[model samples]
Target chain A: MELTIERATKLQTKPNWSDLTFGTTFTDHMFVMDYEVGKGWYDARIMPYQDLPLSPAAVVLHYGQTVFEGLKAYKDDAEEIFLFRPDENMKRMNDSCERLCMPTFDGQFVIEAMKQLIEIEQDWVPEVDGMALYIRPVMYATEAHLGVSPSKQYRFIILLSPVGSYYAEGINPVKIAVESQFVRAVKGGTGAAKTAGNYAAALKAQEVAEKEGYSQVLWLDGREQKYIEEVGAMNVFFKIDGKIVTPELNGSILPGITRKSVLQLLRHWEMDVEERRLSIDELLEAAKNGTLEEAFGTGTAAVISPIGELFYKGEKTVINNNEIGPVAKKIYDTITGIQSGDVEDPFGWRVQVI
Target chain B: MELTIERATKLQTKPNWSDLTFGTTFTDHMFVMDYEVGKGWYDARIMPYQDLPLSPAAVVLHYGQTVFEGLKAYKDDAEEIFLFRPDENMKRMNDSCERLCMPTFDGQFVIEAMKQLIEIEQDWVPEVDGMALYIRPVMYATEAHLGVSPSKQYRFIILLSPVGSYYAEGINPVKIAVESQFVRAVKGGTGAAKTAGNYAAALKAQEVAEKEGYSQVLWLDGREQKYIEEVGAMNVFFKIDGKIVTPELNGSILPGITRKSVLQLLRHWEMDVEERRLSIDELLEAAKNGTLEEAFGTGTAAVISPIGELFYKGEKTVINNNEIGPVAKKIYDTITGIQSGDVEDPFGWRVQVI
Candidate 1:
């Protein structure tokens, strides 16, 4: 495949990385490709990050025919930039495209494009503790048609943003509200795909969670609303009776990369890990009996967010001393270390960007 | 509430009404309003049809936090342009905004803004047979944030498109495909909201249906996958034993305006219209026993798309002589007549735009 790179005419000099916030700032350039009906994805290039000249009838503007993926780039003390298991994000994005009826792109081609974009925008990567360059690859329907059908033409673009830690005040435990009225994903829904619609559906519930003084919403199963599915943007795992118990991938919850890595590391360390449908009753009972020692959420951004208290309706349940559990801290540290190139990547997960 | 109106600086000559197509061409002016965290919604105006300056990190770009509502403006022989049940669209749009976490605008406010926009672009309203001005009201998260939480800002805009009948030749029977592997909406999800995510999620399965030589996909229940939910973009209705039977509003199916109107009409006609869970087995049984008289889909774009053949897995079922069914024609005629001011507004559904 041939590629073209057009540098931005104007580039930011001496970016104030210390004042960076998540997704507020962007680099000078971006990656874009177009896909037509008969022709597949073509005209792939890296160009200046600017506004897209979209038609008023673009499918994404009306039908929300779009999908996206999120990953991060970490810089080590040795001045090396590495991406943690970016291939997972690439594969997940393709999966999302497939579910959304958008054409899928080659994982390797997408990875190569990301590597080039990251290399060009390396200066924008923040150099603070737990701060990294947030990479977003998006696929959208660009066709100027009004029909309720899949878009024939699509646009694929990758943008980069530098940001601080997810919580900003270090990895502190967060209070979460369980919204019984609103549900995130259903069994046969697009929950497994990292599609935009899934996140969009959760926003109102997140508002309710925030109004209740919680950081996120703990989403339950759509059917019975009795089983714990996941947190807002992360996967839930519980340490119960010396065994790692996490909700199985039942087609409604996103299989987080961090969740997978932790499971792998735990299995490699010969720890008990079980993936099954975990119910709220079982968890509360375990917590009451002292079998549930720690509960946390894992994802690309937060790494691991400890659960201090879960506000189920109006009642609150405290968990494991209301602090970052030792297990979660160890996993978070190991994953960050490997991504930042401080520790040896035994799984060969990190890919060098520059 | 205070209101501000900026008239369009540029206007175009009206196009031929007979040449209108669904969502192809827009009117001269559009309504736009911006929102920020503390300031709320501001800069409301009716400006010329143009592109919006959106940042690359806009929440809708990545997370799909968008929702939209569709209605039409009809011009009677007296040159009166009226909107059909716009308050329904307004309520649905706000419901969608609540679901997508976009800022909300009042029903009367949006209706008034749309009235002004349509008034400015009134020349674009089509006078030809089965042609009208298609109005699209969209709300999205405009915040330049990449976080998964609810956005602190939003943008609401309404665009107008002059459209002809969906099927210019006439309402012909359409072949349908049953999507067993894919589902449209799930219980406790955003299926009821007029949000963009639900439509985005349905595109893939609809594409598969089209590829299989079907006009639309007949969505099934997300959990059981045995019950009938809806068609590609419209609400499905079945007539059995001289009674209209449609799927109940189960939080997973879009509660369409046309569907509600059909129900009201049926009830007013002293005909039984049942809204309950409908199973595929029941439909197949009815089809086999010659009891399933007809089937059709209802929406604003496609008033009634009659279903002739339903391809389920490998089995096929033919419905009602493969023609526009009597019930469908009656519902369509009544609804269209009321909309176009040809019949008495018994329900007071039509609201004059100008």
Candidate 2:
């Protein structure tokens, strides 16, 4: 539990905060720890961000044995910083580690480590309206072997990237295409885990969707290809018959932290919210019958991505006249407000780091 | 493709050939190539085997945008090195690239590069009866951006390892457990691709099966969990009522090179062989009636692995009295013979590299 600190002699010039893109720039330092079967996790330190020297036979390169988590640190107008539900992210990362056969750590310990990292990089956090410092915590197998088994050595790293909008069209409704040819995960697969392989398997579908004039692809279940699962990298929600509905976590869907917060916030606000299996047929029928009110995607990157149009089976359905719905706007405003300390934190989800 | 060559001044001591394990040892030289979005694949070179410097934000480290292929080079009594169907491995690697959204290379050109690499490292190939040099060709995203998309930069590397046995009990009957709880892949997932993500997802189940006294786990279809998909990382086959049967290519199973060669060789011998869906219930029923004669798995690593026992649903069925079946023995001997140049070259598979 001893954490060593190293100060960089010289820091690189920071990027222009006003014209920031997603995940392209890094802060001055990074948090790192090494794990060996006999030595355990040691050498916890924050050093200058530099290149990682790995063997050609590292398991993470050849076998994809990696798990990652994403969260954000926001700066209020008064220059105070807060993290939105980072505990949930670390807990979920452990679940992902268990699923992917990687090692896990105490969630609280990692959260404290992350707090120190953010505090050191406090200058990187933007005080703008819709911007924050994105925190990426990743653990990967570093064993220099090509065997098809779990690694005996690992490396845990935490990186900080100052980002603006996740997508190019920031805070705007995005067009989505329902994908039937490719699947993200199956019931017995690694869908529930926020691991590297799940995202790697999704690139082809996402590329195709982008080429077809859609911002993201809506994934269907692998078993039937009839039920909704996720939208691109986000958890999807639908407003049907004046009630909020989303796909239940059926061992194959990612349990998004933002999706959970949205549900909790909706319920706390006395809105009708339910987690159950909803078929594509039912949703499309609701859209045809004027019962589909709004549809949006929730994740740490975008927070609330209002899905304006859904194109499935060569047909397009526009939701809420291709405009942002009141529910989505309110959810985004409330969550972002809480993160910036502008609104009351009734759920205690925000962690004031500094 | 202009290739560059860099020789090492001091060579590292090679491992003992007789005491070799899979993918643990490396040769003196490795083939490498780089790819950029607009520059295409360039900088093809054979350099000293060294550590690969990568950024923490490399897409392969976080999102698993990687694809790899495995083959072997054998040296006969005259120290003549030969490669078996390397073209197929490169072609399949391209297919895997398409599935994982990675950049593809000219299979023929890559094969030529591999031949040159083997020539330069000819002294490293093991000259034993049961041992040879294992060749690993892997390509991964090298872009230091954190976005969940196809990387703009990549690195393809070819590594050689002197090895002996792929499994601990080499050439012996291996006990396998039928896994119904955790599935490997479905029709629409990355099941057919030789990518890192698929292997990462299978480790958990493999670890569980190994702890339960089985060498590997037999994966069923991810959708129904009924029909058998694969045994461990290899393709499975069964002899029932004097006919050879294997699960058909349903898009969720890897099309193993050895499995294809086995089918072709069986047909050349005028044996009754078929590829179709075979359910576990039917297999167990046959075992109950004494008609399930023999079962085996096939892959490049093991060549032909005889399955002596199958454990499923609290039931254990011994195949062929827990011994290497006659058919499996013949196929293994034939394939290994062709690879070593001891047998007649009917399929024109073996390519002399040195």
Candidate 3:
């Protein structure tokens, strides 16, 4: 796929990298492509970052037929830009499109286009200690119709935002509330796909958790509300009785690349890890027995977010005495080290963009 | 509550009334308003029908933080426009907004604004049998942020489209497929809200039903998948053993305006109507016992769609000899007649716009 580039006549001054927030300040350019029913993906171009002109009757606005992917581009000490596991994100994005009845494109071709777009806006990659250029790729139905069917027309766009560290103060552990109501996804639902509706369905529960003095929600299974599914937008893990356990992908949990890497790293170091159904009762029992060693969440945004406390049914259990455990610290350091090119990448996860 | 009117300088030629499809052609003007956290709802205006300029990172694009309402404006023999219970739609739209954590607006003020918009585009209300101007009111988050929270900025816009009859050939019965796998809405989900995500979640199942030679899918309960919840986007009704029965106002079913009208009409005529849980097994048993008289769906678009045949788990049950039953025909005529000003609306359900 050949990509045409158009430079912007003017550019906005970059913000202070250290004081930046996530997904607010954008770069100078964006990449866009369109898809029609008869014609596949066409007219891939890089243009000035601007507002999109859309009809009020667009299918995406009324039916939520849209999917998105999030990743980051980091700059090493030598000013080289690199992307961590973008191919995995692309593949997952296709999975989301299939669930939403939207068309999918070649992942390799889009990854190549993403690389070209990142090269053009490489200056936007922050050079701070924990800051990086957050990349957002979105695909939505642009058909100007009101029917409840798959849209015949689609638009795929890539945007770049310079983001600060997820935890500005440091990698502090957060408190999570165990949600007993308002499920995010079910077995036959669009839970595994990173679609907009899944996130939309999660906002209400998240709001309730926030009002109750919690940072995120620990979602239970939709049917029984017994098994632990996910924690806010991340995959959760618990170290109980010297065994690392995470919930199996039961068609309702997002398959996080960071979660996969964490598991791989654990196994590489000869640690016992198991992926199966982990019930909330079992976890609370382990906490009561004082065998729950460590609990953390893994995702692209914050590589490792330690869960210091869990509040369920008016009961709060503090984990690791409200501090980051040794296992979480090591995993965070290893992942961040590999990402910044400070540690040896034995897994070949990072791909250089420039 | 003041609405500023800005007429289009150049209006496009109106499409042929007979050639129009639902929500495909727009009028010359549209209604728009904005909402801010502290400012409330303001900047109400009627301007030329045009494209909306949206940011690439708009909250509605990434997260499904949007709600919408669908109603219609009818034209009588005097060329006057009428709206069928628009106040109820505005009220329900507010309910949907509350569920999605979006702000609510005054229903009376929006109803007045809708009236003004409809009056300005009175010519767009087609003067044909079973044809009217479809009104779409949508509210969505406009904040350009990636965080999972309610947006501080929102846009509420109303667009009008002249639509042909839902049954262009005639008011014929349609076959429906019982969906035993995919669930539409669970008890704590957003099924009661007229939100975009709910509709997006049903598209895949609808596609599968269509491919199986069915007009729509009859959704069962999300938890047990035993009791019937809804049919496509409409609330369903059944006449069994000389009783008119429809599903109760469960949390996972849309409380359709037309469904309400149908119940009221049945009560007015002294018919035995019941709003309670009707299980699929009970319905199939009634069919087997030759006590199932009629089955139909109620909504704003089709008004009343009779169910001729139901396919469930590889078994087919034909109803009323695969034709429009007497009770369904009467209900459809009564609702359509009341809407078109041909019958007396004793319940004061019609609102005159002009």
State which candidate has the highest DockQ.
2
All DockQ scores: 0.64, 0.89, 0.77
Candidate 2 lDDT score at position B339: 89
Candidate 2: list runs displaced more than 4 Å.
A165-170, B165-170
- Any residue pairs clashing in model 3, and if so which? none
Scanning candidate 3 chain A in windows of ten residues, the lowest lDDT window is A181-190
Report the lDDT tens digits of candidate 1 across residue range B1-354.
555666666667777666665676877678888888889888887777777776667788778878888999999989999999999988888877776767777789889888888887788888876888888888777677887777787878898989876678878899999888877787777889887788887877777778889988899987788999998888999999888999999888888998988999999999988999999999999999999999999999878889999998699898998988888898888999998999898999999877
- lDDT of candidates 1 onward, in order: 0.84, 0.92, 0.91
Per-prediction TM-score to the true structure, in the order listed: 0.93, 0.98, 0.98
TM-score of chain A taken by itself, candidate 1: 0.97
The segments of candidate 1 whose C-alpha lies over 4 angstroms from its true place after superposition are A1-3, A6-18, A166-170, A313-315, B1-20
Instruction: Report residue B310 deviation for candidate 2 (angstroms).
Output: 0.7
| Best-first order by TM-score | 2, 3, 1
**iRMSD (Å), candidate 1:** 1.7
Worst 10 residues of 2 chain B by lDDT: B163-172
Pairs of residues at least 3 apart in sequence or in different chains that clash in candidate 1: none
Model 3 residue runs over 4 Å out of place are none
Q: Could you give the fnat of all candidates in order?
A: 0.70, 0.89, 0.74
Clashing pairs in 2: none
Docking class of 1: medium
TM-score of chain B of each: 0.97, 0.98, 0.99
**Candidate 2 residue-wise lDDT at A171:** 64
